[model samples]
Target: MTDSTIWWVLAGLVVGAELLTGTFYLLMVSAGLIGAAIAAHLGVSLPFQIAVAALLGGGLSVALRFYRKAAAAKNPLSKTDGNLDVGARVMVDAWATDGTAQVKYRGANWVAMPVTGETPTPGMHQIEEVVGSRLLIKKL
Candidate 1:
């Protein structure tokens, strides 16, 4: 029907897609659609309205993604087990070679590596840092 109506419909689609994707990217597009609709309602030109929407929505999405990446890179445990077993002591189940080893912690076997020093032997060890599924460890 009308341009504004089309924008609203597109916004609804964006929100729906975002829900399915479980990411905030589409949500930003929906927000852009809302901006476009608002601009349209304000009697703005079609091109200007679309531009505003694209800039607002796309800009926000990119900013959010950048922030998330920066935060995650700053803190590796931002998404993983940060509080659980972090800075806790565990037992080593293997040795180190080229900064990689295996350790047993909390009744689970985890591959560990020394980030600064030699690899811990099978027994008591301390969890130093965790990057992804690997744990950087030190002898306790």
Candidate 2:
């Protein structure tokens, strides 16, 4: 197939991978492939086409990373519903330091932790945040 055809197929593959994974990685690369296609169509050589694709893709990925970071930094909890129990109350059943901790929240046993200014004891605890299936808790 022609260079353009190959580039188009690559772009399609990138988009497909992005769709399947719901990640921005391949999507950005696919956009770079589109740019490469443009260059190829403009009579650029294979090396130039490949270089452009790599440069554009890498540049976009880095820029997007920084952009996302900046945006997130600007609004540290703008989109979260605070689902991590940022400021909720619960009851601690055990202490979880470097591993796992159990707690009771809404009559449900959940993993929790003690906040920096509070202590972790049985009974009531205020959930400061959630740490990936575990909760960062403090005394209520």
Candidate 3:
């Protein structure tokens, strides 16, 4: 087969693999293959075709990495309860002198501490954050 035909076939395979893996990296490489195919169709030399493909794929991958990093930094994942326990109601039977109490949560006793609003009395409270084995709570 011709070089351009091979490049197009390779690009199609990479794109198909990317679909199965759900990753954009393979798609970036596929874009490079497509660029190489275009160069080959334009009668470019074999080395120039390879260079075009490598530059397009590698540049896209690096650019995507930086974009992903910046996006993650802009919207960081919150580790507080991971949205599983936070905002859940917990019954605080009593509070100790230090504003901490033993509360049953998720079928187990957990150390609960007040982090916002009024100090928790013997009543229901909302879990604001889960710090280690302790639950940071606030008045409901």
Candidate 4:
């Protein structure tokens, strides 16, 4: 097969792997491979083709990392809602002196704590966030 065709095949394989892994970083590297394929189609030297591919892949990967970090910072509690616990209302029978208690939630006992400095009374509470196995709660 021709050099350009080989590069295109490599790019396709990388893209397929990215789909299976659910990592966008692999797709970024595939972009570099496509760039190298384009350089080969243009009859560029092997070293230049490799350089184009490497630069494109590395740059895109770094940009994607920054974007993911920024998105996480903007929505820190996004994943908590998917647990079927966060935002669910629960009945707090009692609370400890430190504003913590064990409450029944989603058919399971969960350690709950107040989100703010104000102490929560024994009544209806809303699950504001889930941190690990614990719940950050607020008065309903």
Best by TM-score: 3
Residue pairs whose backbone atoms clash in candidate 2: 113-137, 114-137, 115-137
Candidate 3, residues 1-102, lDDT tens digits: the string is: 899999999999999999999999999999999999999999999999999999999999999999999998888767652468888999998899988999
Q: All candidates' TM-scores?
A: 0.64, 0.62, 0.72, 0.69
Models, CA RMSD each: 5.1, 6.0, 3.7, 3.8
Clashes of each: 0, 3, 0, 0
Judge candidate 1 at residue 36 and give its lDDT: 96
* Residue-level lDDT for 61 in candidate 4: 97
TM-score-sorted candidate list, best first: 3, 4, 1, 2
N/CA/C clash count, model 1: 0
The digit string of per-residue lDDT tens for model 4 on 33-71 reads 999999999999999999999999999999999999999
Q: Mark the regions of model 1 whose C-alpha exceeds 4 Å error after superposition.
A: 78-87, 91-123, 127-137
Query: Which candidate should be chosen as best, given lDDT against the real structure?
Result: 3
Cand. 1 TM to true fold = 0.64
Candidate 1's displacement at residue 128, Å, is 5.4
> In model 3, how large is the Cα lDDT of residue 95?
93
Clash number for candidate 3: 0
